[model samples]
Target: MNLYPFRCSLALMAMVGAVISCSKQTTDPMEMTSLPGDTVLNVNYESGTLSSGVTGISSTHASAVDANYMVQPGAKGSYAIAHKVVYGDTAYYSDGAYRSESDAVALPAARFAPGDERRYEFSVLLKDWTPWLSGAIHETNIFQLKVSGNSTTGSGVPLQVRVARNALRLRYADNIRVYNFLADVRPYINQWIHFRIDAKWTLDATGYIRTYMKLPGHSFTIVDEKTNYATFAGNPAVGNIGYIKWGIYGIQEGLTRIAYHDDIRIIRLN
Candidate 1:
């Protein structure tokens, strides 16, 4: 008998509930915060330029070498650095994009001592893998941490992350270490992968370098952990400063390799 009035009351209640629900929705943006601890270099490459103030020098060539290296759109953001090393490219065997600083960040002889730890994190995507030949060596340095000496000799650690003919390889000093983390990584081509290096620079038996890698849809797995690694010679007179250079280096003859990188971070953990 009073069904009309009951329906009207129900509609009014529904309208009030709608208004309350709408009011609860927030239009304000979320705030962003930096990660805890000290950061020496944090480059996301969103600026579309290699000169992001993390280092004083960004280069495609160390000594008149020429390769295609530029900041383009990337996986994690709107910008990423792409490096292309083609066979017969002019300049030294060293070719690709790199940012360098002298004794800055965690590379100083004073900053990274025995028991001091530093973390280097970055993401890499292998856009194109160089073709492989039977029994041939296809080694390229994708990331490098070099300890520069006085104009005569240069020594440091280099990550041969891309070895086209076989699995990934890492070259530190005269030693070559291979990893199956990306064994037959051809299937993961064009997919972003994560790489990390936690280094404790020292001359004695206490020194170590722990390497971690994360494939898509997977957590970071330790690829290698080496103790007494020759990351740096104890003699400060040889070189007290170090620098980081990432991008395709040591391009093999007759092969063209391309890769993209983003979110490079260097942190000092005291």
Candidate 2:
């Protein structure tokens, strides 16, 4: 009996299967689920790479995940993640938009739901942020809680943090301004700015959103707050999953914008 040849063929087939499986895991862009009882995600970039809490990276440029998105030393600590976007960078575009951004996709547990109260805390350092040319109104979103999965159900961008026209503004949906956190951002350039957003996702009047910010030699203070209002989307049957994105995303303003993020923590407090 010649069983050696059969065993060799089986080994080759197993090796090929393993290779394909490993490739798929690394190449997949979507992570659909999270570990049970997991309610916290902390990324400090001290490990020199994205943590498992981050499912994947989304960007309009192919090289963005490799080149523009980097782990470096800066931002409130010895290590942080840098997000860089250049003007007219259109290497890869399939994110349903015409923009250059390097966004880290959060886990499914990070999503918001009714009765879900979450606290988002992160530190940002704007490296080269300047007012738009001639004070033009161009959107430069630094953080967003956008609808994922089924985009047709809920609001496109439920919440976002934008730096435009030399100020930082908090917005809901398309253009609803929740608050103007910073009236002037030029003074904070190249300086660390810490933010804490506490949101209680609800459809009725019980929902509330409280935002706090801090700078060097300062303590956290409430920048703005919305209480007794609907924090989540209006649709009760919304099928979309809410996820978090922290990075630079928006229209190009003929200038390279760079920002550093560190100590990003999301705690589900429901």
Candidate 3:
């Protein structure tokens, strides 16, 4: 009856088996899915780094730039990008964080053109924003469809999604003039908002710009819809190459703002 030796042998085998199981465990990184066919650009900032498609452009002032723009954890395992702009920033064009499909000299085929339909969608949560000034316009461009042009002459930016007086507004460039397309977004302030823009760029009478908004626990609502909207008339010299920019661009001094963006995507529908 040598049961002690038998028990010792059994215990040794169990320890060896546990060690083998532990050695087989892996710590490989998970693979991310590629953007869909229609999607020209998609960024959730889950990679903890800015994609090559995104670029941070700012003026000379160091305090107004978004030098720390990076991925941050969001709700339910999701992620988002954070952008901050400080007050009393003298930089004319501060924090021009943007994303484009390509940097080619010529306009990419994926970009929207005449008769081409496209959509831009994103989720924005305003963490902090300065109080709106009465009678005076304190605007900040949070999103824009910008065209390349001469900065000295000051001619560019065909479409702009601006936040002013705690309201979302759409500005489009005309012949030496900028007109407001929509100005009824004051209700969506201080909350997470889903914004969607549908545009058909045309030089003739068929062009149109449509915007949609969705608050939490509700479906998308059409905020603005316009037909025969001419966005490129003012800046004829503006290049065909266009891109999308999103971040806090302070128009006036002594105002600080912070926002979080998630699920930004651009799709070619035509």
Candidate 4:
């Protein structure tokens, strides 16, 4: 005879349970604090420009709007940096390679000095990609950890994240030593692929670089890592410093490539 009050109690209990479920889904601790640290650079491209600790933008022959590189809506938040490269657009050159990149450079002062341990996290989306299924497009670098000042003289870049053979490749070359890692990425096209690089910039054998990757709706997995290896080239005493540059580089083939980058954070580990 008083079932109305009982029904009201049931409704209230349902609401409380729903609220708790929503709270648990929304406030995921792992998602929020997956990589917490002293952030030296945090850029989401939400400002529609290069923000945070970005020193400058380097693009080859970027005359028109969003030519080689521009901040646009795509990767993360409301905007991300778009890097584009077409065939025969190779006026700019660096490290003895023809480049068509819209690279974001982290100048010398913002670079990781010797004995620095840092975590570099970023997300990349391939809006349009010409796979390396055929032709002279053997490989293309999407990111680089370059050596500056007196450090090594070979590639001038110790670490490189590249796209090759329809796969994601990680290459490490310091002086005469070289290492490689590969993961097939054909099924992951047009989807966001997140990467994290924890590295110790050292000239000695005490340095290491561990790379992790995360797919959508999945946890991060360690794709590759190098230990007891040198992470930098040359000598710091001669003015060697290591810096990061991300964009599309080494597109020798006659195909158009477009990629988006966002949510880049460089955390000082030590």
Candidate 5:
């Protein structure tokens, strides 16, 4: 007479009411508000693993070397967006494979873990892209943030790269860029497209970071070119969320592309 611990205590009370309704959602954390993007902790491409922030891009400043591109979750709310091919790493197609239209490259796995609260949330389904000749289809969504000093290249650290891509913009080049507020939806290529990015720290006084991007179907553009970015934290180095990576970017080295990501959720916005 045990009902499997009463269905595991009602699935842990529906995952604690979906994380207290996603921390009491105030709306527009990046949109999609029904949660359950597949559970396990949610991260796309089939839960390779991602919690809330920190993926690719890094710099302790010694000629900067940072990397985080993670996606490993499939089956539950739809993930296996394909690209594990025969299993894992296989780089060498800056634009060579997919001869008929070959494009499938992914990245995201940054977590330096020190100060915490680096924010996360990215989604895809622009139909897995493929139009790179110039009309522009190098298709992107990689919030590559790396600021090893850009207050005029003093050498490094003093980081602050925040991107929302729907309402704000900032950039300070040790490395800082957020993208895609619909520069090319390609007629909703594969349909499911949603993106949510959240970051904390606000007073709007001295140091700045107010980047935003959101394309509610033709009507959102914050620029820098690759897409959207707003980064600049003049001088308080040594904090970490440390490089948040997303996927796909064969930008200027020859291009054919792929796109089809699902409900990627990483949260923490203030």
Candidate 6:
């Protein structure tokens, strides 16, 4: 809402010798890898890598109605942009297509497009209830949202108010658990539990240059598990790859339930 996020949280606990520095503006080649036990990040995962836009670049998902996963009015619709799923009964689309529900499951705000060095990979599968606003649901096999928007959400930008590169999180609250907001890092229902996330942001001129992320399963260790490197600090004027985003996010009364996201892969992180 104010967008001043330069909270390097301490650069992941810096001063160890100070190798942690980010404001994003680069020449590319600041590689730092580690996160492979079993992969699922697509776009062409030989092992992992991509980067090439400005061309016919295209990718999208998230859209449903009479089946479940509502919210498709006008800011526009398409399930938030493209990429959605949540089934214990229904709300899917990895190719299964089972859209048709209405007991009450509203979530808007999460359109997709992560340009720049683009290598976005997200994973889902949650069931956090226990104090997660209530507690004892446990379907969290893994969860992730490794980002790297670098910049641009339209308007003067600055909605979630914090983008020293990209980490704009607007939550419905719960640093961890207790109604588990901010999408609960990637939570809502908790059953189909199986998520994936791989990120890559590399722009420059002061916005980003290197934002690599890898989402491994069973990694739902809990507590935002280091909110994406938990080391903000990267804002080279900000600007990476963007186009569509809304993911309205939900939660507020009735605690929580109904969350599923499947096989979403945006690539360019070669």
What tens-digit string does per-residue lDDT give for candidate 2 at 110-213? Answer: 56777888878788888867655565667788887766544456456668888877889889865556567788888889888988888888878898877788
For 1-270, candidate 4 gives per-residue lDDT tens digits of 879999999999999999998777645422333345478677677767644335564544444344444455646678777777665654444455545454445344447866898878888887757566666536778887777653234326777888877778776674243334545676777888888888888877899888888887888778777888777765666665677777777775567777778887777777
* Residue-level lDDT for 49 in candidate 1: 67
Error of model 2, residue 146, in angstroms: 1.9
Q: Evaluate residue 81 in candidate 6 and report its C-alpha lDDT on the 0 to 100 scale.
A: 20
Give the winner by lDDT: 2 or 3. 2
Sort by TM-score, top down from the best: 4, 2, 1, 3, 5, 6
Clashing pairs in 2: none
Worst 10 residues of 1 by lDDT: 26-35
Give the winner by TM-score: 4
Residues 1-270 of candidate 3: C-alpha lDDT, one tens digit per residue: 879999999999999998976555422101112236877766666665544234432212234346336545642135666666665444323335221111212325434545667777777767655557576787777777766654654546667777767567777764233445435454555567777887777667777777787777787777777777654432334445456666656545555576666667777866
Which candidate, 3 or 4, has the higher lDDT?
Answer: 4
Ten residues in a row with the worst lDDT in model 5? 57-66
Residue runs of model 3 more than 4 Å from their true location after superposition: 1-36, 52-68, 75-77, 89-110, 133-135, 151-155, 175-190, 232-238
- Candidate 6: global Cα-lDDT? 0.27
Look at candidate 1 and tell me the lDDT of residue 198.
76
Error of 3 at 14 (Å): 54
- Clashing pairs in model 1, backbone N/Cα/C closer than 3 A: 65-91
Candidate 2 or 1, higher lDDT: 2
Give candidate 5's TM-score: 0.23
lDDT tens digits, residue span 152-195, model 6: 42222211211111122322111221223133333333333322
Q: After superposition, how far is residue 186 of candidate 6 from its true place, in Å?
A: 11
How does each model score on TM-score? 0.71, 0.75, 0.67, 0.75, 0.23, 0.23
Clashes of each: 1, 0, 0, 3, 42, 64
lDDT of each: 0.61, 0.68, 0.59, 0.68, 0.35, 0.27
Of 3 and 6, the candidate ranking higher by TM-score = 3
**Which segments of model 2 are wrong by more than 4 Å?**
1-39, 51-62, 65-67, 92-94, 98-106, 133-135, 149-151, 234-238
TM-score of 4: 0.75
